[model samples]
Target: MHEMSVALSVVDHVEQAVRPDGAHGVRRVHVEIGELAGVVPDALAFCFELACSGTVLEGAELVTRFLPGRASCAPCGRTWDTGMPPDMTCAACRGGATELLSGRELRITEVHWSAEPAAPDPGPAPHPEESR
Candidate 1:
């Protein structure tokens, strides 16, 4: 499925972004996907796991947020939600000409890194006089 390719791309991108900063691994990845993007969230998640094998993103959580499909009618200047199998025709004016405002998008919005914890701060060295 195309989801596999998409997942691989996500892993590559996450690695590219975090590796430069010395990040040890990725904990989570937040992605925005439109309803009309033609991607199945479950499939993407499964593919993500496969793609991440042997990579820093292995076992990383994939969080997906769905965006509604919206369209604007050119004739009536009206906007409405065009659910799956989007109806491009304007509902208000029954106009055939319309422009898609949103949806059909797949993108990575955020990445949480699994970084190493900082070492505890050591107290100042003991004074020589105190040691004596």
Candidate 2:
């Protein structure tokens, strides 16, 4: 499935973004998917687990936000939700003219890194400290 490739690409990007900043692992990743993007969320989730088997994001949670398909109805003078198959006509007015506004998005928004506990600072030694 194409989901496998998509998941692999996402993992690759997350690793690249985190590895350079002393980050060893990723905790969560936020991905935005649209109804018209033609991506199956279930398939993508399955693929993500398989693709991340040996990657740094192996245990990272794949958080997805689904956006509704929306189109602008010129006759209605407003933007409204259009059912899948992208109904070309406005539901309210039943007009043939309409403008597609969104519902074709597929993007990786951000990645959250696992928080690392701060290292404890050593206290002052018994000997006098040098007054540099």
Candidate 3:
């Protein structure tokens, strides 16, 4: 499924974004997916887990928010929800000319980095020059 590719891309983006910060791992990733984006949420979630295997994003939580499709009519200057299988035509004036305002986006909004693991404590420094 294309969702796998989408998931892989998400992992790549998250990795790239966090790499500069020297993050140990990812805690959570928040993304916005539009209804018209054509991405299956459940499939993407499953694919995301697979895509994160052995990566910095492994074990990270994937949080997705879906945005409803919206369109604006040029003739009527009215905005309305297109819903799934979006109807591009305007409801008010039945205008054929319309502009999509939102709901085609597939992007990462935030990435939370996991806390760095604590270093093990060494007991103490050994005495110097104990042996001659």
Candidate 3 lDDT, tens digit per residue, 17-126? Answer: 73535568888889999999999999999999899887878778899999999999988899999998889998788889999999999999988886663233465777
Q: Per-model C-alpha lDDT, please?
A: 0.88, 0.80, 0.86
> lDDT per residue, candidate 1, 37-124, as tens digits?
9999999999998898778887788999999999999878999999989989987888899999999899999988877532334759
The candidate maximizing lDDT is 1
Q: What clash pairs does model 2 have?
A: none
* Lowest summed lDDT window (length 10), candidate 3: 114-123
Model 1 has an lDDT value of 0.88
Clashes of each: 0, 0, 0
Consecutive 10-residue window with the lowest summed lDDT within model 2: 114-123
Estimated TM-score per prediction? 0.82, 0.77, 0.83
After superposing candidate 1 on the true structure, give the runs of residues whose Cα lies further than 4 Å from its correct spot: 18-22, 117-132
